[model samples]
Target: MNHEHKISNWDLIKNGLFGENTIFRMAISLCPAIAVTTSLKNGFLMGAAVLFVQTMVNITVSLLRNFINPRIRIPVFMLIISGWVSVTDMTMAAFAREAYRQMGLYIQLIVAFASILARAEMFANKNKVVPSMFDGIGMGLGFMFALVVISFFRELLGRGTIWGYEIVATKPLLIMLLPTGGFFAVGILMAFFNWIDIRFYGGKGAGGAGGH
Candidate 1:
């Protein structure tokens, strides 16, 4: 692994949360973002699962970076990711059985999330432990935040509910609960954030180096 740029821990966190947000900014992991985000409860649990796995994988990879051969780093990263994803899967299955029933496979699928591997390779492997941890937190939080936002709107507008609790007598937009609406939600949110990035932040999309 190659050492990348050095920045304050806070900056790394902000970068993961905003500059390189996995869904809204970096545009990664849209499968879960769409499939599991039809409801707020689903979205939150899925995001939580990813957050744990992503953070742990980053820490593990950073710890073993020097020991891993560059030629085999990808396989090593996958192994590390699968190990953590399994932990997340079983933990959720044990404690959050109902939600786990709905998203169990997706939880297992976290092992394949490109964002996790990207972070391990591009940021964590090249950074120190504390910084890598913060980076993981940032990225995980950003991903969770994006899912929460999308699912909030999706659940609210589509089902007239929040986290499965009814808030209205009638459904607002049924389509929002469907895959087409998932694309609509992701696209709209992505553009909205992109506009914010350009209008206020002078715009730098989360590039390959910025995302994980």
Candidate 2:
């Protein structure tokens, strides 16, 4: 039905933040969502990096979509993704060296993120530059929101702190700091978000775990 044409820019943004959240809703890119979310600071940093790279990569891919050969689009996408990641890495290293040192690995890891590549293939490659940019912003912000929510709970419960400031004064759930705790936190929150979608928004529930 070509529903994409009917979707507005604001809806696109909302879709990323809620409809197809990279974590709770879409369930793609769980690795970083879980691994780096042990603390709010780390999660926020990773989210910010992904947001930048995702938006830039979408813009670049949209601009170059027609020029890219169909048979080699995957490779071209990889190149674009890596290129953006490298630029982000270098910029952060130069201007925010200390912070970059902590998040550099995660930023580089964005090169391999399925969500980014999926956007290039599924949305950016087929859309105009302006729409692509907005889509990227929506998706990036969605991912960032998910990370913040997950890390908020994880850090607060796991470490008794939020962004290093003591909140509870005692680790209410030490396991929340561990990998197992990450799974539990994500699962519980995923279900919570799903419930909200279904009950309030009449959403069908999260779609399959992929770029879409």
Using all chains and alpha carbons, the TM-scores for the candidates as numbered come to 0.93, 0.93
lDDT of 2 at 119: 90
Q: Point out where model 1 deviates above 4 Å.
A: 1-5, 204-212
Runs off by more than 4 Å, candidate 2: 1-3, 207-212
User: Tens-digit lDDT track for model 2 on 1-212?
Assistant: 26786788898888788877888876889998988998898898788889999999999999999899999999999999999999988988898787777777878889999999999999999988888899999999999999999999999999999999998878899999898999998999998887877788776667533333
Predictions in order: lDDT: 0.87, 0.88
Cα-lDDT of candidate 1: 0.87
Q: In model 2, what is the error at residue 137, expressed in angstroms?
A: 0.2
* TM-score of model number 2: 0.93
Please report, as a residue range, the 10-residue window in candidate 2 with the lowest summed lDDT. Answer: 203-212
